[model samples]
Target chain A: MSQVSQATVQRVTADLYVEVQQFYARQMPLLEARKLEEFLETLTEDGSIEHRPGGWKLEGRQQLLTEMRARRGDPEQPLVEEISAREARERNVSYYDGLVYRYWFDRMHIEPVDEDTLRVRYQAIVSMTDAAGKVSFEPTTVVDDVLVRIDGELYTRSRIVTHDSPAWADKIHNPS
Target chain B: MSQVSQATVQRVTADLYVEVQQFYARQMPLLEARKLEEFLETLTEDGSIEHRPGGWKLEGRQQLLTEMRARRGDPEQPLVEEISAREARERNVSYYDGLVYRYWFDRMHIEPVDEDTLRVRYQAIVSMTDAAGKVSFEPTTVVDDVLVRIDGELYTRSRIVTHDSPAWADKIHNPS
Candidate 1:
């Protein structure tokens, strides 16, 4: 096995950090607006996205486009993005409430695989609003966006959304 | 067994959320400031923190504290927190990224757990920034915080932070 030196790790880390930051800025808007074509532009045509459930990995741009269209069948909703911490012990765990609101956007999550390729996971919360039309503090809905990166860029490979959480489930306005 | 009503679930969720929020607000400052005595008060006396290394789980709060203290001992290389998320996907299985930012006295991530007991998996790119004279990001020091709810209250029972993803590591760190 080759030894990963401190200098080498440090260099890779810096580049990876830059890549992640750039990815975040690009993906935030399209997710909020539910713009499929615009979102697809971020990916390599031959790239793929994988859904966490059913272990279903969608390959190629065509299947990804199909999934995006299906997602658009439902009306888009508002979501806020933030960062929070969790303390895990043994195996069971719980997350602390309150989060450092980084930059709230219509965005999702992504992970890297190897050097150029990446795995992506996107989510949105579900919540209810009051009669005053103010957004409720509670979460109502959640959407998942997972993708793969090809040639140092990300493309939508797989996606899904669920109503189990109140932020999205109860308030979902199905376009069908 | 009786079905858990949505109202019941909502109430539980809200209460749990509040408790976690309070715990963080109270403890974050002490932990970040490295106020050991004050920080220790937040734990349940016998409380412990864990990190993943190879095929085993590290145990004990004292051990964790000792490790943290030693890491902090590096004066030339001060340790700080920096968590950033990239993407996420959720369904029966959830995936996530780009939902965390940590800075010594402050930390945040979108934590998702199962509805039954509220055991959540931490899926975020957690970066630590080392601040000596000025604040800078630490690329090599990354971590994940796992959590669980107990007795109708939420608390971080465990943490599984490792250099690589866990065995069940999927997508994580989306706000769902």
Candidate 2:
């Protein structure tokens, strides 16, 4: 084991901070635009997203992509890019028609694991806007994510999310 | 800022891991014993404890100590230390009577901030045993804490505790 000098800690923290912030800023727009394919490309093949409060942990890229599509899919319509405008209008009754998702991340601390791997603790909020532009923000989740640089691109290896209030995750599934 | 050598990162991780584990082992016993003064002494003057599932963040040592005493106080009587054995039995109407708290820390990861401070991510479970020896474990909390070494003694600067399940923290406040 080698002792980390003060200089080394500062250097690692600053670099990792930049890497993670840039990744989030870019990927969040793709997520908001519902460009799942492009967003998925940014993730590693073994990446996973976990909602810790709900005990929802899906591992592996293929499993995540499949589950994500289903979760974000509109049951009444075909995929967004594949459907025509008339077909999209037909699905308005489902309330998912022309749906929008907005997500933002606040700066957080970065801790290095290795030259290629680090962990970031960040606070983020996601808002859901219906076809009518009725936007609602769910409770915030402080996301602790393990990020790695592969082929000079940053990817989230694992994400563990925590809610601010107790029972918030339960409320998400079973509305009051 | 200087880049950390692979050896430095490994050394810091190993040393901090051992230091934190030893600290918890000793302090948990003091906590189980309900030795508030000694427990308080182990915390930094500006120590804060945030229970995340509720967004309950209290800062400063005095405020924390006061609230902790109230929350964990023996409702049937004063503190356990000041009460007599017969008096303790007389106030044994609630299960808090003869309540014994046993805590177990499963694992911890150390992330260095500087030579003096670092954050430790730890998973811990606490079980409460009544006078009848019936023990039950509440849901676990993964605690993210900042530890600082002051005067050669490790002190908890801040603790952000997030439970494994959504409703666990609420359960503590309102029992079923």
Best lDDT among the predictions, by candidate number = 2
Give the CA lDDT, 0 to 100, for residue A50 in model 2: 78
lDDT of 1 by residue, A39-127 (tens): 66665666565433223466776777875564333222222222211112112222111111112323334445556544443444322
List per-candidate RMSD values in Å: 22.4, 14.4
After best superposition, candidate 2 residue A113: deviation in angstroms? 0.3
Kindly report which residue stretches of model 1 are placed more than 4 angstroms away from their true locations once superposed: A1-62, A65-176, B1-12, B53-57, B74-118, B124-155, B163-176
- How high is the CA lDDT of each candidate model? 0.38, 0.59
**Cα deviation of A96 in candidate 2 (Å)?**
5.8
Instruction: Judge candidate 2 at residue B172 and give its lDDT.
Output: 38
DockQ of 1: 0.02
* Residue A106 error, candidate 1, Å: 8.9
Measured against the true structure, the TM-scores of the candidates, in listed sequence, are: 0.33, 0.45
* Per-residue lDDT of A69 in model 1: 62
